[model samples]
Target: MKTEGGADAAKRRAGERAAEEVEGGFVVGLGTGSTTAHAIEAIGRAVDDGLDVRGIPTSFQSRQLALEAGIPLTTLDAVEGIDLSIDGADQVVDDADAAAFGTLIKGGGAAHAREKFVDAAADRFVVVADPSKLAARLERPVPVEVLPDAHTVVADRVGDLGGEPTLRSAEGKDGPVVTDNGNLVLDCEFGPIDDPETLAARLSRVPGIVEHGIFVDLADTTYVGTDDGVEERQY
Candidate 1:
């Protein structure tokens, strides 16, 4: 599960499977990241194949990509329930011994807020990832999206939690990368998270915090691509 194209391929395959599972004229919630890019590509293929679908993108970049792919765009306000959402994650934990899935941490791209919004508005949420992302215990730095103006305040608050917060940025870009919501992203490195749900709740409650890249138990299923093959997990 080292760095390779297998994860992206797995993501693409999962996206294709999810796209085929969708029904006619359904509203689709799109997510962000490299893996999600594959999902979007698959959705584009579905559209090319004549599937009636409308997409709601979670990020500005994602919106542009979806439009470029010829997927019809729409706002969530106009759509009621999304048929399904295909997204990616920073980490996914599966206790095969316990036969459980859907335990995950997302928001690597600082699109967690919108992704969460879309996930809540969907009938089903599917997470795609590589087997390397899985762990015996889910542990990773949780990302937090904040208002640029609140950077100082949030940083101080993050320190109280024994976490180091760094501003998220893109190469060749000055300042922090602002989200579609006009908020800044902070990569809060708290080390291995003991309780993702609790941490998510705490960070989200902080003022000037627009959103955090932590997703609780929102996924219904997850598809992991491995060198051996693809693995499916359902909550």
Candidate 2:
């Protein structure tokens, strides 16, 4: 495991490596999180160096970062498709039941809903992370965005699926944490997920589930920063 500072440096290195994949005239899907923030900064620098690209940010924070970086912004409706998406993950698991690239547990920032949308819209989805985030098995709880009115119902349904569902709370606010899409988040713990693909499919069927954080089969590749160097894994 890496220390805090080492992990942060690794993240930046991973982001910088992923940024190398970008090209002129590409419509990139910018992801959220600290690792992705490094990518945003690198992309901004590229723009200053005369690279022409448009960014579709996954969150308000990412949008602001892109704006500051001088990267032109566009909406999904304004673009035909995203050339690439660079993002981070809370955990990356090598599960036999997952897609060839494995599975991801995201939404720590509560932007999984939008992140999923933009990621799927992209031609390629790339994950950048530090070595500490990788695991033999995923242990993080899945984040499920739900409509406020369906919170209780969704919790019950998730419980039926053998998950312990807990509503995510705001850090500085009085109530539950609400997503940018106006939905509440349910952090569902199904310890050591055996089949991420099936789990993601099942979660989608829950009536109130707007989007769940089990990013099954979406990642095309992952760039991991380690003490030695950045390693690239293709799914």
List the RMSD of every prediction in angstroms. 3.1, 2.6
- RMSD, model 2, all Cα superposed? 2.6
Model 2 clashing residue pairs (backbone): none
Which runs in model 1 stand beyond 4 Å of their true positions? Answer: 1-5, 96-101
Candidate 2 global CA lDDT score? 0.91
Model 2 Cα lDDT, one tens digit per residue, 1-235: 7543577888998999999999999999999999999999999999999999999999988999999989999999998899999999999975445442458999999999999999988999999999878877778999999999999999999999999999999998799998889999999999988778888899999999999998977999999987667888778
Against the true structure, what is each candidate's TM-score?
Answer: 0.90, 0.95
Clash pairs (backbone) in predicted model 1: none
Instruction: For candidate 1, report its TM-score.
Output: 0.90
- Candidate 2 to truth, TM: 0.95
Highest lDDT scorer: 2
